[model samples]
Target: MHDFDFVRPQTVSDAVRALATPDAQALSGGQTLLPAMKVRLAAPAVLVSLMHIPDMVFVRADGDVLRVGGATTHAQVAREAAGAYPALASLAARIGDPAVRSRGTIGGSLANNDPSACYPAGVLASNATIVTDRREIGADDFFQGMFTTALEEGEIVVEVRFPIPDAARYEKFIQPASRFPLTAAFVARHSGGARVAITGASESGVFRWHEAEVALTSDFAVQALDGLAVDADGMIADLHGSSAYRAHLAGVMTRRAVAAIV
Candidate 1:
């Protein structure tokens, strides 16, 4: 491993200071970072570890929002959030293996914003907030591209606030190798209308499936999801799943998600 300054800050302010550097990298569960470092893929001059911050690992339900701290692990969310938002909790339970769940954090996952990741879809459908010391970014604006986010330098995700929905479900077909979603859907019943977010299908990363949303909004039924057209342009095309296959699965999983919720 390359020698570098490893800073473990106990507070958000300290973390911010550590990240003020031009080449500082935020460390969350180290699921992605450590491996990259081992292969010399990433060589950050300063490693700012967020794990020691006690205040960033809590979960609470306040009125209409379910606020989850950035350091909260998937396993932690799986156990604590199940009773309140079963869909999200179940989604957390299904991310990666048990080891990954135990250490992989929401903040890290959101910061990484993998194209096939699960939380982005759920957050988008739930209309969640990606809270940071700098600003609170809406789900629609937070995620920008594959493995990229709207997070600026020195900005760290403090928490995620998901608006509690009436009903919700996340369904996906996991690619066996990496366990990334080949195509996934998160469907929710909100006050304005039914929301359906699709991930793993598009090169633009996770996005709301408007075609599927339109069909479900009209009838809010599984059968209504039939004949929905998902745009194949700029979709993910890889060895695991073709762009067309992922597009088709987006519709299928969307209907399945709707069925699961309704």
Candidate 2:
């Protein structure tokens, strides 16, 4: 990779101050960023590591919401979050491989907002809050599009607050080689209603399937999804799968998630 200065600060304030330097980028797990740097897809004059900051790496259950530190690794969540949100823990446990799970941070994944990433689906469906150094952003408003978010330049994700639901499930159909979801659904059932989020299939990125949510919220059963069809117009189409196939999977996965919850 290109030459760059690296700094590991012990506090959020220190890290934020370091990031104020021009051309500096925040480094969390480096699962995505380091690979890009290796390929010259991304280059920064300075790398500010957030993992060194103690406040940015933790998992805590706060009443009905689970507060997860932004720098918390997937493995930690997979282990620590089961008591608060089992479905989310299950999702974390299946992301990529052991190495990727150990190094990748939730903050990095949400910040990058990769369309195929699993966390966005969970966060969105759970109606979680994305807390940053600047302000808190609702999940509905946080994800802008594929690889895009509402975060301004130099903003840091501090933590995510996920409101635990009455019941929840995430079903993912993954590409064998990459282990990234080709199509996935996360369903969360609350007292008021249900929320459904789909990922890995949308050309526009992760989105809520309102029809399924309404149906599931009304019935909370697999049979409730009958007659529901996902439109393929805006789905991702490539060598791996067709837009039609992905759209079909979106519906199928949502049914599976709801079935699991039921």
Global local distance difference test of model 2: 0.95
TM for every model, in the order presented, reads: 0.97, 0.99
For candidate 1, what is the lDDT? 0.89
Tell me the number of clashing residue pairs for each predicted model: 0, 0
Cα lDDT tens digits for candidate 1, 178-257 = 88788999999887788888888988888888777777777899989766778777888887877888888898898888
lDDT for position 115 in model 1: 88
What lDDT score belongs to each candidate, Candidate 1 first?
Answer: 0.89, 0.95
lDDT of 2 by residue, 1-262 (tens): 9989999999888888999999999999999999999999999999999998889899999999999999999999999999999999999999999999999999999999999999999999999999999899999999999999999888999999999999999999999898999999999998889999999999889999999888988899999999998899999999999999999999999999887887
- Model 2 earns a TM-score of 0.99
Candidate 1, backbone clash total = 0
Off-target runs (Cα >4 Å) in candidate 2 are: none
The RMSD (Cα, Å) of candidate 1 is 1.1
- For residue 98, what is the lDDT in candidate 2? 96
